[model samples]
Target: MSEIVRKESFKHVSYLWDDDEAAKLAGDEVALLIYRSNLLGADLRLTNYGGGNTSCKAYAKDPLTGKEVEVMWVKGSGGDLGTLKKSGLAALYVERLRNLKNVYRGIEHEDEMVELFNHSIYDLASKAPSIDTPLHGFLPFKHIDHLHPDAAIAIAAAKDGKKITKELFNGTIGWVEWQRPGFDLGLKLKQCLDENPGIRGIMLGSHGLFTWGDTAYESYINTLEVIETCATYIEEHYGKTRPVFGGNKIESLPWEKRKEQAAALAPILRGFCSSERHMVGHFTDDERVLEFINSNDLERLAPMGTSCPDHFLRTKISPLVLDLAPDEDLSDTSNIKARLVPAFEAYRALYTTYYETCKHPNSPAIRDKNPVIILYPGVGLFSFSKDKQTARVAAEFYINAINVMKGAEAISEYTSLPRQEAFNIEYWLLEEAKLQRMPKPKALSGKIALITGSAGGIGKAIAVKFAEEGAVVIVNDNDEARLAKANEEFGKQFGKDVYITAKLDVTKDEDIQAAFDAGNIAFGGIDIVVNCAGLSISKPIEEHTDKDWDLLYDVLVKGQFKVTQAAVAIMRKQAIGGDVLNIVSKNALVSGPNNAGYGSAKAAQLHLSRLNAAELGADKIRVNVVNPDAVISDSKIWEGAWAEGRAKAYGITVEELPAFYAKRTLLNEIILPEDIANACFVFVGGLLNKSTGNVLNVDGGVAMAFVR
Candidate 1:
């Protein structure tokens, strides 16, 4: 799609409608509705993830009546506008929906309206209608947008919102007092249009904005014009009194220092938040968040909470604002932890009280008491959720709230939704039902794994297996090219936000720390570590030099030690018992000629795993080993000399090595990298979870190398 750039004097927001994209879906009202929504939703300034609803009314052939009738299409419950699809839209008979008001008893009976909405659906198989459906269906216009754009919401959240609305648009835009969205609110909008008779749009109090036109394009333009006007007004007022939020109270740390603090703090925060269920973390040091956190009014504004219901729902009623005084040292980890522990406990207590205060007879059971978002004065915001995307989106939503607060405080006093009102929406019976319908989480749903040498071979197999079980993985490798390839393949398989990449050498302490830091910044911290990075050099003892021995020990033994040592520090800080699975070898136990260096290194790795198991048992950190005899398939260790050396040691050609190794096993099976990965998973996958210091021989029944 292309745009004929508008000559309007508007700044602050763009007019992104592309004629070519619209033309492709010309005459398809639903597609155009989706197009308009994508453009509005593409920018966070316009709306947030799954925040608002958009709709269009058009004539459609009623299958039952075989006659054309007006039908309304709206974003389905829990659908994000940016990714709205035909399947994500609910289609309903407009007249039937409007007629639902006839059966509506009152606001108390609004929860029952959904069953009536189900009956009004034009197609029974259409996506379920959201609670916001009435706000669209009851409207008189052919097209409408209910957006929580920051500019629009800034005005809506202001203390004098109604008066400001009246003066800003000069009667073109009307205002409706704050009311929970339902049939009653929809009817109030209808009443406003009736009473005024000529208002172009309406501003929803403590909520969002409504703009409509006969066509989708026209509606899109009206929305843009309304938002730009609000932006212009806010900026004009903001200029006179810049440095809003009552001016800055604390100075922002240097850019790198802020991120360093965030990285160091994320795992601890994630562990505290994961008390009930393991939670993934997302960190953002974006300047906007910094501006707000460093502001003097942060203490006053943060607890009042966000005004918009969308922002309130994802971010919770309030954030856990860490008490980091301006004079406090950001690098003092112990002092930070001391304050955080008590602060977290207090937040939980507050939430319990809030739930008790707002409970109705039929309210849903109290949910997890952890706050979704956390803020610190010198550092940035960290959001926690079951997976990375939700965590990231929750962080994004709070930033949207920050923007809303910025504009509101710049112009007028900002206010929050009534406590009871926010609670009703959060714990509403309908919202509970939505939560109930969610699919069951995977076994390792919130566990994060960091797999060394995951760019290929057995390491990659372990990574894929872990990710498949709902664990987010940090795929680690020293090879840049291989890491990129692994990243691309993993991304294709698992989509974004579930996995991250770390390029590092396990042999170097700096590299190991950087890897863990990357994991902390990306996913809080890892709960599983697979020490799978290794290579082989099979040679006669007489021919083996000091270089060969050092090289072998450095990669196979020392590398695993360094990575696990770093992982233990993180696991200890998180206080989350974790899994450390070492990929050893049958060579460690079985005697063979021309294998002195490689075999001794494997023995060191095996002993280290056992020692780690004994030493770390009190911390509940499990260390186990998997010994696979021959995992030559697609392995970098078996490319040239290693393969030839192993083949020669067995008195066979490279092509015959597989068959020979298989025949040597009692079960006569050729072991693969995946078999080794399966053994690794068994140690950590809750099957053999209680048994640490264990050895699993995945050599297809090679009795000579059996653990016993």
Candidate 2:
């Protein structure tokens, strides 16, 4: 029987090259290639951050021989093409690289291939070349660009991928079946080029696309042409029928309402997905993600596999789809927990079976078998990862995958690489070794920390401390300007993407809920919560007004309660146990004269920590109190009327008051905000992993206030 052909009219591919700007960069070829790479990298539709590679070959004077020789300048490992600089491309002598293929007397292992590639580098100062260096090196073209564009992958991952490629590009493109990337795949690519000398591009079935030309513009424009052609094919054949969920579905809450719902659901999902170690949860209700989650065929379609094999590295083979009842109340903690527990258990069992069946005997052991993407019916999608940035990256890729899958299913049935092929990519020794070479994470790495009133003083110190230790910090404060400043400073110190900021009023329930949601969305979930938001009010018992009492209690006691409640709900749901540190005043234990309202509310806050410890110990949640006495350095709390009052009461000026307080301590040391932060870290950093309901004093040894 003759095969049915699917024809699609070609669409114009957009180019982003700017000749005026390109004129400013160093070398003509290098500048043009960098410009082209940034153009491709800037568009997530073309290629996302660090997801694709580009290269150009030029003749350069060989230092030792003083003869013109070919050198390949390819995108280096660990560099993003979007913001690529000339230095981002690794330079290697093309002849030296090609000669290594002759040196290859069939190696028994893949690691040896990587070693051989490393030794071929011509410049010692250049960054390490990407693993696909050989593929670009062997191809007989002046310029080459390889990208896993969603449009191309949609066509490449179909059941009749080869037929589709032949029909679309006809005589101009060659198609290769899926093969694990290494020396073998590189050799096969060279063979394909040699056999199809007239072809301009090659489509790797169940992989991605590669296009090349004699010039940078030719190669870049050709890549866009291929992708645009595939996109047109999907559009023409698919008929633009939007995916629809068939059943009588529960009405989804609005975006803002769903965020609140996510905050409630995150903890439960985190707990269910967690092992002995905690896993953070990030929630997204993106329009595309919502469409996928709401699809009637979601249960069948979502679990098939990733849109491309590269995605398996981030999202794993498949996402875990939850069978959430339409009528179930997501606000009810008990109901959500009950539903997630069984769903998680089933997912674990299925994951174990998949791993056992597909993984090679030599495959490295799985890190954490939990699914990275979690599709919660009414709540949207929750992505899990060791840290916030990784979780966000996974979400970005999965969102793209969802769109690709939908597009493929619309045109033809969406298909992916076989189970074992995905397993090979996931456990590939070359990829695994890259991760092994990374530096060890800090003590609190991958943990998410939320600090209230983090704009200055002790709160700010704690935020910096946690961030320095590799925790994804959620900086919360009512002061917008200071919060932005803090966010910028943290970003400057640790890449801006490391921490997120939330403008929050701890006393407000909506603010508390929103902050938690932001943290959950930024990272995966909250692991540590520190309640350090406070204000000082000193007055005699009879002189204290109701307003003064209310403000003091609202911030110190009630505010702490609400934030803790939100955090505890998430922690309990994540089931990975967490730590809660309350920054209480030493007045909580020893009341000073004329400080009735402040001391009383602080005392209440201290006792509340004990109550939470007792209640949440079974859940493995630890609660402790940090009682800091008269912290004077870098403290905004001691700058106003409260400072003058305390100083006057101590029979000294503000400058002398610090010394007075220091002498009161048996150790005679002035307590700094950092000192308080250190004590706070001891509890939240798991130094007291076995202990809770404890009070750690940072008063430089205030004998009376110290708790034994």
Please identify model 2 stretches exceeding 4 Å from their true place.
1-14, 26-28, 86-88, 105-111, 240-253, 494-497, 540-542, 659-669
RMSD of 2: 4.7
lDDT of 2 by residue, 614-666 (tens): 99999899999999988877676797878887876666897788889888888
Candidate 1 has its poorest 10 consecutive residues by lDDT at: 1-10
Candidate whose lDDT is highest: 1
What's the distance in Å from true for residue 299, model 1?
1.4
Q: Estimated TM-score per prediction?
A: 0.97, 0.91
Q: Give candidate 1's total backbone clashes.
A: 0
Give the TM-score (vs. native) of candidate 2: 0.91
Compare the candidates by TM-score and give the number of the best one: 1
